[model samples]
Target: MNPTTTALRAGCSRGLIELRQSLTNAGELLNHVLWPVLMLVTLFFVRDVSFGQSGFLLGTLVLPSILGMNAAMALVTMSHLLTVDREDGTLLRAKSTPNGMVTYLVGKIISVSGGLVVDLAIFLVPGLFIISGLAVGSVGSWLALTGLLALGLAATLPIGAVLGSVFTSARDQGLLTLPILGMIAISGVFYPVTSMPEWVQWTAQVFPIYWMGLGMRAALLPDSAVGVEIGESWRHVETVCALGAWAVLGLLLAPVVLRRMARRESGSAVARRRERAQRRVS
Candidate 1:
């Protein structure tokens, strides 16, 4: 194979292996089951209403929003996985070899992005049938929703890279998870941002999560989901514009951040960290 193809394959393989390993170690099955089970149980016994009537009034809308959260979570986990590999000396060994760093990183992105796609399908497909009917209207609306989802994932990558660079161990992941999940909760994933304090709504708008949720809502829900004026005009166009801007910004910054991380990763640093851990455990 050509060098480019070979590099892509190597990167993809490494990424896939890491992704699977991370999921198994992290209880990926528990997470998947937890979300849908919580959602369905609340819908059936806890709430007398149909899916739409439950407090999740936007059941049709919530699926895509959750999918966006899934994308962000997947990217964040991938970032942490990469960091663990680096910390354990895998990255140092690979750096000493003929395998290119760029290829490996690209493979990581591809592998994680593939996992995100699968996660979305797993959540949304059965969700459409079970919770609420898929009602995006025409083929065009479906296309727009798909585009929004892809762009949202693009926007999530840089943030994930930054998080991965900062955090080191499973303990760190536990501490960081709450903050990240809080960000999502406040980002209007569960309800309209307008319901929050003005300051909270303003804060939510600053993150890609808000735009991702808004974009998904725009795509899935009917015009009624937004304000009357916004619904009348079909505000998805604005969502596209806003999300596109975030996607562009994330793309521009992700590589620079990742390169800085690669530069910081070294055999000596990995060894020191490992030695310290050993000392602590002993």
Candidate 2:
């Protein structure tokens, strides 16, 4: 089989494993799933509120923001799991195969993409029908939303790979949750970016989540929180340009980070640290 096909097959295998595991645990009511449900209910009660149909604007905005949040969580979860896999010798065994990175990344894309689809269906679909109603009327808008979600996933996957390669254990994984949640809060996932200060908004723009939220807002709303008109020449061009830039940067950086991480696997320092972590956990 070709390298791509081999990678793809490995990816499929990993995705199936993750999907079955996720579905099993997803049955429980946890903050990740529960919060969105609560928010959707809250929004439904106040559907008539608007700043120029900002109810519809907010409805559309929230979905992509949540998708961005999903992307962040996916990155963190995958990083931790991948690190554990590496420490436990799973990655080394996998690397013996052809195109390890291709296989690993493809698998992650499938798993994360699948999870996000369910997340959107459960969170956004109801919000659109219950709150925004017919605001999302056009096929173009739906296409735009899908494109933005894909960009969000593409941009974040590299970050996850980088994290996986860099972090060596579960403690580092716990530490990641703070920064990730902080970024999500500042990215305007739950609130409007406009409500945030100018400097804060600028800072948020450094991450893909903000751009994803902005692009989603543009696609979903007639009016934009970022002060640009969607589908306008400049706006449309900038959207394509920004997403493309992030995707390219991620692809370039991921391999470099992974190679460095692979080197650490054999070092005495890592082994000592891993042993200490195991002792602490035990």
RMSD of each: 3.8, 3.7
Off by over 4 Å in 1: 16-56, 133-137, 228-234, 280-282
Tens-place lDDT per residue, model 1, 96-126, is 6665675667767876786666666656666
lDDT of 2 by residue, 201-279 (tens): 7788677766676676667666434442222222566666776787788789898888776655654555676788779
Q: What TM-score would each prediction reach against the true structure?
A: 0.80, 0.80
Best by lDDT: 2
The collision pairs in model 1 are none
Residue 205's C-alpha lDDT in candidate 1? 69
Full-model lDDT for every candidate = 0.66, 0.68
List candidate 2 stretches off by more than 4 Å.
25-32, 38-64, 223-234, 266-274
